[model samples]
Target: MARRPLVVIGSGLAGLTCAWASDPQGCILLTAGVLTDGAASMWAQGGIAAALSPDDSTALHAEDTWRAGAFAGDRAVIDRITGVAPEVVRLLVELEVPFDRAPDGSIDLALEGGHSRSRVAHAGDHSGAAVTTAMARAVRAAPHVEVREHHTVTRLLADASGAVCGVEVRRRDGSLEVIETDRVVLATGGMGGLWAHTTNPTTALGQGVALAARVGARTDDLHLVQFHPTALDVAADPMPLLTEALRGAGAKLVSDGARFVDELQPRDVVAAAVWEQLTEGRTVRLDARGINRVATRFPAVAELTAASGLDLTRDLLPVRPALHYSMGGVTVDDTGRSSVPGLWAVGEVSRTGLHGANRLASNSLLEAVVTGRAAAADAITWTGVWRGSVRPADPATVRTRTCTAAPAASRPLPLAQVRETLDSACGVLRDGPTLQAAVDCLEPHVGDDAAYVAWLIARSALAHPLSVGAHRRTDNVLPEGVSA
Candidate 1:
């Protein structure tokens, strides 16, 4: 019998990198939407982080990463990921992804919050879209790689011994089918979409978390979700993000038209500071008046602001803390292997211990490519023996659900009730009682992917007693009632 193809579940940079690195002839790429549009990667505004400047080094980058994650991340993993960051940038350049360049032809780096050096390489403000478009072009030309769009993987398939075999997919026509495969790489995006106010696509409901957990894969740090402090406070669902690059360009955060928190502090600190102001009913906004050629430097942001009846050059854009990134996920090793056998995770889906609590501004894109390559290299050679279990499960799938299905809704749970529950219980400030209450309220809806992930996040928050990084708890007060 012929060997089954390696299945990759996502279209983000991580998934694309895995497909390009793997044996293309045996690689199958699946996307819940169009190849380039669905991923949160394309929504990324700040660029990839790298220590490529003359005055910088990997050690400094690693130091910044460890500090931003609140010292809880694995130091070794930070060193490994930061060490390879420069090379990742070079690879992207070679692939014709145009990074912004200085006058002397050096990679122009932007200094975002929590970084000691200007090491983020970007192409304008649409860094994610530009990079993803270039990678998608390359993948489209690769004849051996099969790209399937609009096919949502509802569940992961595993044998009785806990070795993964395939996935249950929801097709475009509203029918479900199963694809049999031995290797599965989940590059699914973060759980930001579960929150009422987030920057991620609505479909990014942590399907990867639910799918993996149902099969007994271990997850961690689900509570360590980073809330970006400057999402444009409009009436839109999934609020538009104000790029950290603005702060790097000298924008300031102001309340009552007066500056308050330092705009370039670590994300958790800045977010909490902003949340304090918001709770006090003060208006927080990103003041971008000082940036020269603001529209030219950040055209995408200019467009977004223009649509909202404002100008990045002249307006004090109202802002608030909103769910931006998840720092914890299905726990994985250096090679993106989850505890479960024959299954791997990369990108935001896998907790590689690189981002222990709060992620540095641009480290996510770097980790995506680095870990994606690792999982692909390992998956290419694995012989389907997971953790010493030699059970030879056939690559045949069995469908367990009825063919009919309801059209997927944008919000997973009761939109109004769950939003209030998550924002109040798992928002910037959290406590034991509220976390437990949020879990209890959402427990009945755990069958829904969004609600299940929200429940997982709340449960994780309740389990960790101390206020560390993004997982802040009001009740876990220290000597000064602040983090050390």
Candidate 2:
């Protein structure tokens, strides 16, 4: 019998990188929509963080990450990931990612909030799009890899041994198909869509977390979500992001025609500051007129502003805090292996403890590439050493635990209600009563994936009462040694 191909779910940065690295060993890449369309990775405007400059070092990078994350992340993991970051950038350059170059023909770096040095390697402001597009191109040309667009994975099938043996996917035509494979990697991005105002695709409803949690994968820090301070306050359903790189390039966050908060502080701090302004009924705008050649330097942000009938140079772009990234997710080790056997997770779906209470700016892309490559390498090794035969379980059995088709009584609340519940309770500032109320509201809808993940975040937030990093609880008094 032919060897079953390893299956990778989601087609974001991590998924693409994993599929690209699998190469001759091969794997099946699955995406719910067209490749790169719905991915938060493509929406990323800030670049990947790396210590490539002469003034910077991995140790400094690790320190900045730790400080930005509020010292809640694993030091060892931070060190390892930051150590490998420079090498990762080198590899991306070789992949023809077309990163912006300096006058000296060196990779152009940008300064962002929470970084001690100019370490972000970007291709204009559309760094994520460029990098993801390059990787997608590589995956398409790989002879060994099979690309299956619109194959939405519904369930992870585990055998009697409690090991993932296959997955059940619903094709574009609504027909279910089963692929038998011992190794499965979930790179399904973050749960930003659970909030009403998010920069993520509305479809990113935390399906990866739900799938992993149901299969007994360890999840941690589910409540620690990072909000971006400068999502353009427009009338769009999902808000358009004004990249932090703009602020780095001399843009100021102003309200009442005066600068209020430091633009280069950590995201949590800046987001809170922005939130405070909005709460006080003061309009906050990002003034980027001072940034030289704004349109040429950041074409993506220019286009986003243009669509809203605003010019980057002439307008003070209205801004507000919006749900941006998740710091908490399914727990994984250095090689991106989950606690469950034959199961691995990468990207925002997998919490590798590099971002503790909050994520450092531009670190998500770095983590995505690192974990993706690591998972691919380990998956290849596992397939080589473990040649155990496995059969696909009944597709019906797999769908039994899925969120779809739940009985009316236990069905999930509408996405609007879910968003309203979370948005009211879980913003930049959270309190005990609001969090408890959110938990109570979402408890009954645990059968639904969105509700389940939202419940997890609310529960986690309520359980952690301290004001640490992004999971700030306004009702709690900080302990003697703890930083608020």
Best by lDDT: 2
Summarize candidate 1's per-residue lDDT along 297-317 as a digit string, tens digits.
999988988889998988899
Query: Which pairs, if any, clash in model 2?
Result: none
* Candidate number with greatest TM-score: 2
Q: Candidate 1: where is the Cα deviation over 4 Å? A: 387-412, 477-484
- What C-alpha lDDT values do all the predictions have? 0.85, 0.88
lDDT at position 231, candidate 1: 90
Clashing pairs in 1: none
1-484 in candidate 2: lDDT tens per residue? 7777899999999999999998678999999998976899998898999999999999999999999999989999999999999999999998899998989998999999999899999988889999999999988999978999999998888888777889999999999999999899999999999999999999889999888877777778888999999999999869999999888899999998999999999999999999999899999999999988999998999999999999998999999999999998888888888767788899999889999988999999999999999989989878434332222322321222544334541776999999999988998999999999998888767777788888888988888888899987888856568895
Please state the error at residue 395 of candidate 1 in Å.
Answer: 26
- Per-residue lDDT, model 2, residue 390, is 23
lDDT of 2: 0.88
